[model samples]
Target: MDIHYRADIKGGLLILHPAMGIVISGKVTIGKNLTLVGGNVIGFSTGINNPFIIGNNCSLGANAVIIGPIILEDEIKIGASACVIKNCINKGVTLVGVPAKEINKA
Candidate 1:
């Protein structure tokens, strides 16, 4: 399991096992205690100057793709195989599926 992170992390970051392939670009900024399940990609530049931001205590599942210049608030959970291309305005929410939509965990 090889994990490559070239971003600015404010605190601790844990990339879990079974990490098939993980890549974090240099244009991203992550908060404290980020739990990455593996096989995930964060912030791959596509000529976009906006920086990708991740909040504290966030968990990104396996095969999760969070690209572009977007902001994810604190305590967010991104499900496996999820592709997020937008900003997560609310804090402490769960996002899943392609294009990544916020779901209510009832």
Candidate 2:
């Protein structure tokens, strides 16, 4: 997992698996207690804005791609192989499938 040096983790614990192929952009801001599984990408889309913001206690499953200038709120969970391109303002939600729709509330 290669997290860019300029990517900000604003305190608390971050659990990143060793086998995970996580790529985080330098302009990304991650909040506390983030758990990232394998093949997760948190980055900006090509020709899009930077500064992806993730809130606290968020968990990203395997192959989850969170791209562009999206904002993920607290306690959000992204399912495996999900692609998130928009802002998720609702907390405690579990997003799944392609384009990452909210399937359930945790």
Candidate 3:
């Protein structure tokens, strides 16, 4: 199955290297130069009012799930299968694991 929702995509967003599966639901805003790998699921955590906002030049690893109303700044890198609940990450950083911790500043 082609795991991508072109309809959910916005202007100037790029999805690349999807190695597994990608399911896009809810309201998602992806900035320019953004790349999502296969297995990266970008959508809402629940039937809430907020959605997910990914910053420019951001890269999501395979199986990474970004949910809720959160802000991922530019140049953000997410590890595979990482679960991001609700938080704001600074630019040039790498997040991993459940609840998504700031592993390193890239």
Candidate 4:
């Protein structure tokens, strides 16, 4: 796995699937129990040093991409192949689809 992350992760990080290409930027701040399924990319595409913040107990599904300047609050679930370019600050919300809209709140 080519996991390249130069950031701060507060607690545990779990990658569920056995795959390659995990890229996280240096400007990211991840909290506890960051459960990731399969390959994911968390970075800013604009080349600006925008901070990507993932709160505690968050789960990202396989092949998820978070292209930010965005903040995800605690206990959020991102579905497979979701592309989140905006912020999801509501805690315990489930996000899915290409632009990753909120499906429901848990």
TM-score of 1: 0.88
- By lDDT, the candidates rank as 2, 4, 1, 3
Clashes of 1: 0
Off by over 4 Å in 4: 47-50
lDDT by candidate, in order shown:
0.84, 0.85, 0.73, 0.85
lDDT (10s digit) by residue, model 1, range 1-106: 4334567888788888653777787778899999888888886658788768899999999899998689999999999999999999798999999989999642
Q: How well is each residue in 27-105 modelled by candidate 3, as lDDT tens digits?
A: 6777777677777777665656754677788888878888756777888888988988766567899899998899788
Candidate 4 per-residue lDDT, tens place, 1-106, comes to: 5454678888798887756557777778899999888788887667666567999999888898888778899999999899998889899999999999999999
Q: In candidate 2, where is summed lDDT lowest over 10 consecutive residues?
A: 12-21
Error (Å) of candidate 3 at residue 79 is: 0.8
- Per-prediction TM-score to the true structure, in the order listed: 0.88, 0.88, 0.78, 0.89
Window of ten residues with lowest summed lDDT in model 1: 1-10
Q: Candidate 1 deviates by what RMSD?
A: 2.1
lDDT (Cα, tens digit) per residue for candidate 2, span 4-103: 8999887774556757577888878999888887788888867766557999999888888888688889999999999998899999999998888998
**Native-to-model Cα distance after best TM-score fit, residue 92 in candidate 3, in Å:** 0.9
